[model samples]
Target: METDSKISKKTSQTILKLQQNEITEHAIYMNLAKRVKKQGDREILQRIGREEGMHSKLWSKYTKRELKPQKLKVTIYSLLSIILGYTFVIKLMEKGEVVSQNSYALLTKEVPEAHKIYLDEQKHEEALINMLDEDRLQYVGSMVLGLNDALVELTGTLAGLSFALQNNKLVALSGLITGISATLSMASSEYLSARSEGNADAKKSALYTGVMYIVAVILLVLPYLIFPNSKYIHALVTMLIIVVLIILSFTYYISVAKDLPFKKRFLEMATISLSVAGLSFIVGILVKKFLGIDI
Candidate 1:
């Protein structure tokens, strides 16, 4: 490794930033490790944390100045780990690690050690990241089932009801009744399905599914409650917008946490949902025209 004096000013600055990042991640992982109850998880986190510290120390020889962990970053990750779980927080940090890997590539000419660090981070940390297991992630399949079904079913149902009923309160009431009934049905079905599969967490899986389904229901129906009877169209537009936003949000989360492709998943899910709603809206218009229904 070259001396700090020989390294360019720009290179030194980048090294300092990378060093701070490594120390911050070290703090976060160690903090989580201490807080974690599982022995296996604690060991993994501790090992990762120590490795980050080692990276930080290696970079320090170039910067030639001690850098403290960024307190704000550490605090934020700690809080998020508490609220969102360690799995989610660490997965989120993996994005930063990727950027660091890129930066390390750029530094290979000035610092040959950067290449080694990059490879270790890319390979070893990746394996460790995948090794991490959490209880919430265990029921992700159930949550996905709940969210996907609710979005596709309720969005279509609301679009049709908005046109057929032509009254905001009426649409909202119908949506709520339908949503609640479906929630119960979906939950029971999940329970039975999981039990049949011989899964031990069948009850918990059902709870996660029902809870995710109803939450989507509440958000979808909220627009109808807010708009007046005269503005059912506005309510319908808002509900559709909410559906897209929900898809985007959930898709982004899953992509980050599970390392899935975001654009394809988001586009596929959104297309299915909006297409169903569009078909349902046309059916509503046809049904009303043929039956001569009046509000």
Candidate 2:
């Protein structure tokens, strides 16, 4: 009696597994057929249906149990699977509502066996959505990247100008004007771009970018104020400022991304700064050689 009871339990579990696979296969075949619409649909349906039949045969072989119609379990599982799968696919598709509804209708009429798989997949989708929402800081690296860009470009502009132009009130004034104008222009563009983002945090990104630009510009002009009329000295000062900006940018990046080693970030920032400063210096020398005329 005990052995028979164990066999019955195992047979019942096997039947449930077979039914579940049938429901899943039905959903897959219906979705693929709806999207692709080829004779391959019949082939896919037959292949999956055969797998379900094989599962049933395996259960029969093991326990000599015949497949019975468990009306309640099949009905409940089928409805759940259809609902879950339909909900997920419909939401993901742009104009999927009409297509999803039509597919569901056709599926119910044509492939009733595979609906259970759709429910399992829907559960998986729900789990993924929940995980994404839980990890809100996933895009923080992007914010750090934007900040780094604002710092390097603005500071480099000031540094190159300091190198090329005489370190005097005029150069300082130019830096101030250029910094303010660039910051405002950048902030405005960022605001416009972020207006479509539909989040409070998006506006804050514009503010952060603007602030970094202002800070970088001010740092560039600091050496000029410290050593007035020292044009040669100021060239070295500007280079130092560029070095510091590179360091700060790298440090911020390292802090924001703790997984990245400091040496890697430092070398990366140094390479970029050197490349930019080299180009700017070359341009300045050519301009000074031709335009300054010093004549």
Each candidate's clash count: 0, 9
Q: Model 2 off-target regions past 4 Å?
A: 1-146, 235-242, 245-253, 256-258, 293-295
- Most TM-score-accurate candidate: 1
Q: If scored against the real structure, what TM-score would every candidate get?
A: 0.93, 0.46
Per-residue lDDT of model 1, residues 55-98, tens digit only: 89998888777778888989899998887689888989987653
lDDT of 2 by residue, 1-295 (tens): 1223433453345344444444444444344334333354334434444544554554354344454544554455345335333222222321221223334334433335325434543465344323322111343443454445655564456555655675545566776787788778776766677677775566666776676567666766566665666563564456456665657664644443233456666767767766676676566567777787331
lDDT of 2 at 224: 60
Error in Å for residue 263 of model 2: 2.4
Question: How many clashing residue pairs are found in candidate 2?
Answer: 9
Candidate 1: which stretches are off by over 4 Å? 1-3, 98-102
